[model samples]
Target: MRLGALGTSSIAWRRTLPTAVRVPEVDLVALAGRSADKAERFAAHFGCAAESGFDALLERPDVEAVYISLPTALHHEWAAKAIRAGKHVLVEKPVGVDAREARELCALAEEHDVVLRENFMFLHHPQHSFVRDLLEKGRLGTLSSFHAAFCIPPLPADDIRYASDMGGGALLDVGVYPLRAAGLLLGPGVRVAGATLRTRATDGLDLSGQALLVSPSGVLAHIAFGFEHAYASTYTLWGDRARVTVDRAFTPPPAYEPVVLLEEQGHQERFTLPAADQLGACLASFAAAVRAGGTDSAREGADLRHDTVAAMELVEAVRREAVRVTVDQ
Candidate 1:
């Protein structure tokens, strides 16, 4: 698959471009940036063509797919444009600022007969499969509750996440990591039980928040996320007879060994999961989906769309229930 990237964003440089190049199924072919100089620099580094803008990149017949890593607010716009141009898209997480937009994107993808995938790269990791296996085998002894947290220290004032118009918020940023993890462990049909959001005083952008979600079967997930705290990305599952804990649940390096801590009856069992390149897996999966096109229908795409809707619904509900916190108050 010949892949192009829209926007020379930081993630494209650090993770997306480098990882996509490593995927055997993907060919990093082009990049588009608002600035010609930045686009050329990124394209040179990745050994691809540099287009002056997204529209120019889209015009290239060789670009079969695109990775949209622009600001959150621009995802829907550019992703829709790419789909309309008959190019498959791998958008950054929170594919849209809300459920309505996500639904629209899914519809556009369907209408255009192209594949659309949100880049929740962590889901592609093998460690998650290992955890799922334990649950399927009843090793966790009937799941009860799950707790996840993905908090990070503050960024500079100029960071895009602090900009309210750009879909910046704690819930949209680090929060989505644990929220998606919650769905993974509990199920997709989770409902928000309650939530609290803290917004920036100056512009009303969320900086921290937490929520409780309950599944139809009564399973619960407690998710906490923030942008002004110590760094941590982890989750723990509690069951009737056992508990499992994993560290670095969101951003583990390709070679980083994953360890799952299992506790039962005062005995601690630790399992070492094999290291894998989750970003590569993500890119490869999307490329394969594009190659298959509409001929081979995929349940994963449908499930992803469903999950995206559920997540955005929960986010809005939490926002409505939130009690704003500001620097003055």
Candidate 2:
């Protein structure tokens, strides 16, 4: 699958592009950025061509698919355009600012007979499959509760994530990780029970937040995220008979070994999982889906579209139901 990139963002330069170039199934064809110098630099670094602009990249006949690392606000617009151009699209997470935008983009992809996917790269990590195996074997017994948190130190004032109009907020950025993880572990039909947000008085962008959700079977999930805290990315699942905790749950570096802790009555166990390149795995999956291009591909696309829309719906619900608190800073 010939792939073009639509942004010179950090994730594109740091993770996605490097991984794409390594995937045998993917051919890195071109890169586009608003700044020609940056685009040329990125393309040169990755050994691909540099396009004049995003539209130019999309217009390339050699580009069969596009990776959109643009800001959250630009996701729907560029993804819609790419789908209409008959290009499979892999967009950064949060797919859109809200559910409506997500639904519209999905509809466009389906109408144009193209594949549209959101880049939740963590889901591609093998550690998650390992956890599922433990769950299936009753390692955690009957699940009773889950807790997740993803927090980070504040960014520079000029970072795009501090701009409200650009879809910047803890919820859209880090909060979505725990939220999506909940759905991944708890299954579908999880509903927001209550929520809270701490917003900056100057810009109304959320700095931190917490949410409570319950699955259909009554298992509870507690999720917390923030842009003003010591870094943490972890989750714990509690069951009637035992409990399991995962450190570095969300953004593990490709070479970092992950450890899962399991505890029961008078016994504790630790399992260390192999290091894996999740971003490479994610890009490879996208390439395979684009290459498949038939009923099977269509089914995968439909399933991914559904997951994207469902995640957005959960985000929207949190925003709507959250008890708002403004901070003077």
Candidate 3:
């Protein structure tokens, strides 16, 4: 797929684009940014053309698809535009600010007959599949509950994550990881039972929060995330006969081996998994869908669309049910 990038965001520079260039199915055609110089720099680094604005990049006939690494608030707007232009879209995670926006984008993609996918690259990692296989094989016995956390130390005050108008907050930025993990591990029909969101008194942006969710089958999920804690990225699944913990649940570097610990009656074991490029895998999947075309493209995108909407709905539910608290800066 000949791909255009719609932003010069840090993630695009550091992770997405670098991995994208290594994917055999992807062709980096152009990059667009508000700043011409920055766009040029990124395009030069990636061996692609640079455009001064998004419209210019979209107008290029060589671009069959676009990867949007824009801010949370801009995802729906640009993604909708790209879909309307008859180009496949791969927007960064959280797909939109809320469920409503996600649904709208999905509908638009269907109407325009283009593929739309949210960039939840972690979902493509094999470690998750390995965990699922273990659960299916009864290694953990009857699943009862799940616990996940993806917290990080505070960022520089000037970071976009701290800007409210840009759809910045802990819930959208980091909390989504655990929430999505809950859905991935526990499956659909998971609903938030309770939630709490802590907002900074000065900016009214959320700083930290937690949620308790329950699956229809009585499986429980306790997820916590924040931007005001030590770096932690892990999740544990508790079952009747045993429990398994993933030490690096999210954001593992391409070359980093992941560790999964299993604890059983009077015994414990550690399993080390091979390093994998999840971003590269994700891009290849998107490229394959684009190449599929017609009915195949739509069929391939259906699950992704469902997952995107479902994840956004969970985020919306958390925000709605959260007991809001104000923390003094």
Candidate 4:
């Protein structure tokens, strides 16, 4: 299966995809970017085929899928096109800028009878399951609360992360991971009780954050994210019996070694998450589903659509309590 990668200012895929995609079964055939000169350099640098235009690459008879790692704003446009072209699509998180777009994209993918996977790579990792098993086994005991935080300082004054037009915000960029962890670990269908957003140097974008989501079971997950704050990154599930803590839950080093502190019986059991590139695993699964005709005969597509819409619902819910900390906005 030949795959085309679209719009990466940084070569994240160059390092990660090789591990996730089976080289024998999948080939990185083409790449597309906004810069022709940069595209040439990226192709030469990554050994990608000369077909650099995104549209042209999608038209390739052998190109079976398109992995879209572009900015949040560009995802819907390209992903929709890929689906219409009768090819499977893997879209990065925050699948759409809003609920309406997400809903439409999901419907379009179904109409075309193509695979549409939101690339929430963490969902595919075995480490998550390993921890989840402990949770189910009552190791963590009765679940209580979840607290997750992800923060990274702005790269530059003009970095895309600070740009509002690109659907940029601490909540959308970093918070989503923790928020997803909260929703997933605590079980889905979250209702936001409150949210507090801190504005950055740039107006309208959250530089720091606080969002509270409550599950039907009354479990609460608190997410703290920032584009200008500490390097703290961790996901913790607290329970009546004990708590399980995982450090570097998201964007972990390529090695995929996650550590956890399991407290029970008056002891702290330190465990290491296995070595793996979950992003690759996610891609592989989507590919497998495509190869098998599908995992749910378009029912999987419906689930993807549901997830996209659900994510947007949370984002909009959080935005209500966003506080302006700067004069710019």
lDDT of 2 by residue, 1-329 (tens): 89999999998998888889988988999999978999999999999999999998889999999999889999999999898888999999889999999999988888877778889999999988888888889989999999999999999988889889988999999998999999898998899999999999987899999999999999999999999999999999999989999998989999999999999999999999999988888988887877777222355677778878888899999999999999987
Model 2 regions more than 4 Å off: 294-298
Point out the worst 10-residue segment of candidate 2 by lDDT. 294-303
Tell me the tens digit of each residue's lDDT in model 4 across 1-329: 57787776553446444543454456777777777776677667667775658898789997888878788898889988898888888777878787778888878877877778787877777777888999889887778798888888656877776788897777888887877777667766987898887775545667778888888898888888887775877888899889888887776655857787898767899888678777667767777777877432455656656766777778888887555565343
Candidate 2 or 4, higher TM-score?
Answer: 2
Q: Compute each candidate's TM-score over C-alphas.
A: 0.97, 0.97, 0.98, 0.91
Model 1: per-residue Cα lDDT over 1-329, one tens digit each: 99999998889999999988877899999999877899999999999988878998898999999999989999999999998998999999889898888889888887777888889989999888888888888988988899999999998878888888998888998888888887787876788888888877777888888888888888888899998899999999889989989997899999999999999997999999889888999998888888886422367777876787777777777787776667631
What TM-score should be assigned to candidate 4?
0.91
Cα lDDT of candidate 3 equals: 0.91
Query: What C-alpha lDDT do the candidate models reach, one value each?
Result: 0.87, 0.90, 0.91, 0.76
The TM-score obtained by model 1 is: 0.97
After superposing candidate 3 on the true structure, give the runs of residues whose Cα lies further than 4 Å from its correct spot: 294-300
Clashing pairs in 4: 20-280
Window of ten residues with lowest summed lDDT in model 1: 293-302
lDDT of 1 at 31: 96
